[model samples]
Target: SKLWGACRNPWDTDRTPGGSSGGSGAAVAAGIVPMAGANDGGGSIRIPAAYNGLFGLKPSRGRISSGPSVGEAWTGASIDHVVTRTVRDSAAMLDVLAGPAVGDPFTIAPPAAPYAKLMQRAPRSLKIGVFTSSPYETEVARECVDAVEETARTLENLGHRVEYARPEFDGMALARCYLGLYFGEVSTLMDRAKTEFGARDDDFELDTRLIGMLGRTMPLPDYVRRRQQWNDFARALGAFFEGYDMYLCPTAGQLPAKIGELDTPSHLQMAARLMLLLKAGKLVHRSGQVDQMAMESLARTPFTQLANLTGTPAMSVPLAWTAAGLPVGVQFGAPHGDEGTLLQLAAQLEEANPWFGRYELLEAMI
Candidate 1:
């Protein structure tokens, strides 16, 4: 079968929509569905949502099922979620999707009532910490900074006390650690493909081939070191949450980039299209730079990834938009088994702002 060239952004026809869940985010933003399914191994859902002006929640790992198909994806880094225009849509989908499959390696217990029900209630006033810096080495866009500041104002209007806060630990080190693990995982997948499916060098894109070659050369100590980094990052986040109910941040560092802005096809033509895709993955995984659509996915998972690693619940709310009219999301997260509080707070914000169910572009698409 012929592969679709690439998914195009609904907002800008010339741009590439995000992936591997780009279609979901685009469909939701276009209003084809109230919300659409998404999964994040490394910012897949949140990136697209950020690009398309929708809310994307990648709940705690194992909080939703990945069963009757495969056990764990990307060595447990991947989690199921949805991209939506409203907070309640995300809450409602969580109600439907958050559960475990029989014989699963890990599963979070279900919430007491459907998340939809909880969204109807108000939450008590809470302290929120805002962090605007990119966890990675790259620079964040000014629009993203402005969006977060606006979110702070919005939260204040909702009666929540807000303050600028930074994580106590080193952001750069955290970025390095995440990259190590991420690359290591990519390496592992490539190795498996070769061994299990007898995949040849030509079967993969250039980047995949490079990753597989690197994986073959990685020492056992490298794996152990990456695991240690995960542990350290998890501990830092746990400590950070002790003083704040939720942490707010940009889903992406910048606005969505135009499709193919990352590279021209001529530059990528040195390698096959498969290689181009692999190169794209490497670019996103290594540099954390993505097109507007790609950034939505790229920037989201780092903050959310810790939640998955630590078994905490987190959500992104479509609370603000850029001056150019692109949607901007504010993320809120809680400790493990704390979806109740998270949803309650989101619901409260929804009531206070009443921004839910307000995607005009999406409605037009239908």
Candidate 2:
């Protein structure tokens, strides 16, 4: 609970800045920096972008290399990039940073030209599928839905085709599959901690330790089964994309949560207690509890995980604000290796409905 004293949203000081790239979001939004580095294994990049009103993109899996330091993270669900105030900044950095480092396991051919130049050119008339409802069985905020609808209208005015549509997929199953890998990683981290410091239960956060405990209970075969399921989802989503240039949806299911609203200390205490239950060989009864808990959290931020599963490029464009004056973003996902499409769209959106002044307002407040 005391990690960073809760990174507060500058837009609405009581709200979260979003994480684990939350520091990047807060710094960029407060005008402390033009941009800041971030990475996403799940919605880490986009969630903060939505919460802080910045442009955040999680590039295709192989587009940027992780090598010489670490071959990959979360089995390639993660990738590194920056969160920026403007489309051009992200584009410029991508041009400078994207490419294979030595001993990289995968490499995608660099863009034909620099991303900054690509941002200048108009994107071709594109067909986009738009959905306000989360594919997951979760409730989406009305403002979030409105933000997406408004962005779709804006795209239509720009001569792009926008139609109400969504791909067919089981959000729950995908979430469960993802959790297996996610939990396993947490468990592995605890192992490292033990090696480095002879860490104990109190060495980690209560919720984190609970997650690690759950991860340990998961068998290696179950983790492998989950990883293999990625291909099944990839094929299904790939087919859905064949009919459209991009998919548009809310970046998050709800507006930003007030600071301390999502504070998990009490919940973590419960989790630590749950660990005791499991150790007493109460496996059958409590195993489902953590999975359900995870699902409840994932339901709120559902849309971004699909791109991570399929290794497609996705970006969150800060498009609108709530009645309470908090920012809300609309997300767009493009085919693998088609980040140009997302950047081109972001530039168009930036030109049509500029967000340059939100930072200035934040600056004034600061």
Which candidate has the highest lDDT of all? 2
Q: Root-mean-square deviation of each candidate, in angstroms?
A: 5.0, 1.8
Candidate 1 lDDT over residue span 205-318, tens digit each: 554554454444445685567656766766877888888877888776766667656543565445435544454444443444322323333453444455554555667666
- Least accurate stretch of 10 residues (summed lDDT) in model 2? 278-287
TM-score of each: 0.82, 0.96
Superposed Cα RMSD, model 2 = 1.8
Please estimate how well model 1 matches the true structure, expressed as its whole-model Cα lDDT.
0.68
Per-residue C-alpha lDDT of model 2 across residues 236-280, encoded as one tens digit per residue = 878878998999999999888888777566766775676656562
